[model samples]
Target: MANRTTRIDPAMIDRLADMAYLDRNPAAVRKRVEGMEHLLERLFVIPGINRPVGLDVILDLIPVVGGTVGAALGAWMAWEARNVGMSKFQMTRMMGNVGLDFLLGLIPFVGAVPDFFFRSNTRNLRIIRKHLDKHHPSTVVIEQ
Candidate 1:
């Protein structure tokens, strides 16, 4: 097979750069962080339920499929971090958090508690916020 070089459109590149810029805007970053927190709440916290169980932990009670689904959702946060220009080190650390959460969460009964507290999505969101704060200070929201 011959080597095929992929051609990228300049306009598309410009559009993506524009999107990255917008993503680093304070308002947009705040919205993204809020969305991540909401997702974390739904997955890790059950409303009015006395237990520490969330949908992800509850889902893990199923079998292999449950863990896979939870991991996929956790990975979404890392993807978002990448989109906003997180460093390779930060991205790797985020992946590690997700991986650790997924692995430990596989332990039948004992896994649930750890999964509830590990909160990889929340961790990844923090990493994204820190990256934005340092590299894209304009994106950091300041509340008086």
Candidate 2:
């Protein structure tokens, strides 16, 4: 019987490192933010909408714990952004969207309606992506 060598791909290793450190170190942060940015735009950025709504809007439709669940989702995503080397300013902007969604969500039916349209996660994701672009300016950033 021949034994096969188990090898981890460098990209996987880098991804793990990136996640572990939350992209705090500049290079790692920049790379991970690229992902967050792409995800946000894809999920939320509607053509001609000017402002894209986010997934939290969907969450708000649920009964009692919906808003909390939505906020947690946004927070987890944002938490990764924090690790990915986002500046305090950028992080603040990201958190602001989540905060808005959470607060608006607390209201009754009216709030739920808006939540569907707000798309906070997508907005914050863009903020992270833009920051990375502004600071990092990589030539390879064209969307695949």
Candidate 3:
């Protein structure tokens, strides 16, 4: 076989750097957490009733594993919040929201029902947004 040269893709490296930035930067972290919250709490709206629904509710519908998965995702949001220098009191409140969501979600068929109203992910997102807006005012993005 002839000698071949392997070139590293600059675009791929940029993407990787962007992903890493999301974890450490306040602005990037805000977008990352907002995206997750949207996915978990408001991915779409149900027809007729016009109510929104998301993966959180769908996951809760499954037996034990679903709640665990949802809780894990919520915990991850809290972790990201900490990475942005969020206060301990705020983190505790965020975790409490996740914990309560997980506990309510453990109730088999009925568990999913609470998710529609509880919206823990949305609640947590609000906390993160408030913190970011107050401390990192430059990172704030005005919602249209």
Candidate 4:
């Protein structure tokens, strides 16, 4: 037998181009912010479900990679938020949270346990969301 790899659909590829700006990490900072904003919504809050499902499941549940992946993703979002006009202090605080999650998550069972309940990504998202809502209302959907 010969090894083979799966092929992506061309139509899907085209659709990706037509999609929103913030769907992926573009070169521009604003675009990156836009991407993270969209991801935050889809990843945490289920559309039309009136409930939020944030990064707790991904980071805390899995083994070593879980928390690391989630923390990195959240950090990316926070980084972009700064480009979207978030203040330095706010960005620093978000970075602090990311650092905390990564550092504490290094421990075997105990660290992973707290990461779940803490839900650092969700908290960081909320912080970024609030700042964007208050200042850059035109960029993101701001809710009370």
Candidate 5:
């Protein structure tokens, strides 16, 4: 029997570390929140009205548990905001948006309508981006 020694790449280790603790970096947090916001609010555009739609609307279309799931996702953004040292007032406003969206989404049949309009995740992402741009200027990326 022959024993083979495998070599591990240092770059791969660094990448793994980076992925493991992405939330610790302001830039990574910003990117993470932005991706989530995109998923929740603007995954695709509707053909006729040219409106962007995403998972928040789709999830809200489900019965009872849908609103709860959507709210939980929004709350996760709030958690990420806290990790970046957002002010309590900002947090309150963010949560309020989430809470309102959740309540509106609780309505039967029409729940998705409010989700389409309100977009709590996008609102929360805006709050996070504003904070990051102010406090961590280097993390700011110019949008083309």
Candidate 6:
């Protein structure tokens, strides 16, 4: 058996530490979370209509390109999760959510309906927030 040595990047650790500091700030954390919510709303939740439909549904109607764009956006969310220092398990789960959403979205007309209801971005955001809450409690503020 051979022993392998791994090198850690100090700069990367410093960057993550800075992000952790930002996460600890309640206002900053709230702003970030709110921004994510707004994005999900724009993508998944339709306005002025009681039905559950949004840009993701409308865009996916365009066939290949639309679904691809949506999937790319979902992948960006997963990448953001990684930037926030989420565990590999958590990141993998986030990626799975996006992957499933993308695959299901490729199914012709029926795909649009699922895209509207699945809300993968929102789901991933929830997972990110949960991870922050558990591992970085300082980021969450409990109002009395």
TM-scores for all predictions: 0.67, 0.60, 0.86, 0.56, 0.85, 0.67
How do the residues 111-135 of candidate 2 rate in per-residue lDDT, one tens digit apiece? 7777666767768767766766676
Clashing pairs in 4: 22-35
Which tens-of-lDDT digit does each residue in 70-144 have in candidate 6? 778777767666656778998888888878877888887788878777878778878978877887787776759
The clash count of every prediction, one per candidate, is 0, 8, 0, 1, 0, 0
lDDT of 4 by residue, 21-125 (tens): 444322344445445644533356547956554454445556678667867787887867765667788888888988888777767557765664565666676
Worst 10 residues of 5 by lDDT: 18-27
Residue 62's lDDT within candidate 4 is 64
Q: Model 3, stretches more than 4 Å misplaced?
A: 1-22
RMSD of each: 6.8, 6.0, 2.8, 8.7, 2.9, 9.3
1-144 per-residue lDDT for model 3 (tens digits)? 999999999999999998887779998898889999999999999999999999999999998999999999999999999999998999999999999999999999799998899999999999999999899999988779
Better of 1 and 3 by TM-score: 3
In the predicted model 5, the residue pairs found to clash are none
Which of candidates 1 and 2 is the stronger one according to TM-score? 1
Best prediction by lDDT = 3
Rank ordering of all candidates by TM-score, starting from the highest = 3, 5, 1, 6, 2, 4
Off by more than 4 A, model 4 = 1-56, 61-63, 140-144
Error of 4 at 71 (Å): 2.1
RMSD of 2: 6.0
Pick by TM-score: 2 or 6, better one: 6
User: Any residue pairs clashing in model 1, and if so which?
Assistant: none
